[model samples]
Target: MPDATASILLLGATGQVGHELRCTLAPLGAVHTPGRAAVDLRVPDAIRRAVDEIGPDLIVNAAAYTDVDGAEDAPRRAAAINAEAPRVLAEAAQTTGAWLVHYSTDYVFDGTKRAPYTEDDAPNPINVYSRTKRDGEAAIQAVGGRHVILRTSWMYSRRRSNFVRTMLRLADDTDRLTVVDDQLGVPTWAGWLAEATTTICNSLLGAEGASKAGCYHLAGTGQTSWYGFARAVFAQFGRTDVAVEPVSSDAYDTAAPRPAYTVLDSSRARAAFDLPATTWTAQLDRFCERIGTEKGTPKAPFASV
Candidate 1:
């Protein structure tokens, strides 16, 4: 357990998840978030130096190479940041005797499961990103540090380029949008992920038992295909003006082969922490409202095609 007033070191503070984490961790005492200027994950020495300097009681690694398709062409670069850096961070955390919190992804699975995947599911990553993340997870465990690994999927936010924003933009430009209907998974909001991390940290601090550490799935409540998700996004914008046509994955072949079924079983997280599950539609609603307010545009469901 951490001290009643513990200091935390947070990495990847500029990314979507990291952005929310920075804000959420403020209530925790002395939370230190290093920007890319201060600590670059690409530099192992920098990561080592930052950990040594901060000497925090807890280290939350929100940093990762999240470019799914881009990783295919740049496997070595992805491996360095996604796999090697976490290994260094875990080692540093162990040397400093601090608890570590790392993030993984659903891509770790091959997406062959008919239902949601459990933690025990053997990881058969089909892409470079997943393979590197799996290696990172192994490195974390091998380092023998007190840690918690969260495997989440389809993460997006109102602040960045994501499905929600894409749908909104395309809806404004075209009357018909084609999306892959075969790929299925839950869309996780970065805000929710950050809030959940905060909850878990609080739970860990309150307890006196052994360090509550293990891999768990954290995603939205239900499942939907990308096509279904797009339709919902359009609905939220009051935009019946556009039609979301369902297309097969083959039609939109890309660099990275996406898993057809990436929906993760979040039962363990919900049961363990009693974490509330947010629906996909509700998340889209919140995102639309937030983005609309930010752009000073009308939050209409849809505009005429």
Candidate 2:
């Protein structure tokens, strides 16, 4: 376990996972979350400066350029944040002797495998976003620092503008929802990720935990497609009146092509950290409960178009 007095430097404090990390890491140690004014990930020098200044015992990076389609138009911008920025952080961690905790995505895979992707699976990124992320992972490994890379998928939170929130908003404003069912992956809750990160951090900071430093899949247990996830979200809100149609990826025009399947096998993470597995439906239920309690009432059910 990490020392109770350890100082932690957390990047991307305003992001979905970052927002939750700030709260979850508090009990573990002092977490310094630098805003964009202090550390702009787009600027490599800023990241170096923040790392040097904080000189933390642990550095947890939760930031990334997550716009899959937007990345197709701006590959350089994506590389700067997803690849170059992480290289800088890893180097800093090496020099400062601080452990680095980084987050990755399941997009790194081509998703052709019939089963879930494991940590050892060779990455064959098909899109710019995934390629950049894959590069970032390689950079960290090449830096040879005490780091742990967590690969997750379909991340969502109540605060962020993610699929869950988008579906809720659409159900409130529209009637029919046509979602893509071809793509498949786990829908990981940011809250659960943050919590798991803390556990992983504690283990890494412990006496025998250093040897556990490597890549692992940290995501929700069960799997589902975009269409299935949308249906679950609507069901959570009692919005069965809405018609949810399943469509193939070819039905929609996009700048980038999504993977056909990217379900991650988190057995390594579970065995390593003794983390419990949770189904996507269970996680979604918890998320909905939180949203409902916060909002005080569910919006009207969506109707067929």
lDDT (tens digit, per residue) of candidate 2 on 122-155: 9999999999999999999999879999999999
- Superposed Cα RMSD, model 1: 3.6
Those runs of model 2 whose alpha carbons end farther than 4 Å from true positions after fitting are 1-3, 294-305
Among all candidates shown, the one with the greatest TM-score: 2
- Number of the top lDDT candidate: 2
**Model 1 TM:** 0.91
Reference-based TM-score, model 2: 0.95
Residue-by-residue lDDT tens digits, candidate 1, 7-49: 8999888778888988887776678988888888889999999
Clashing pairs in 2: none
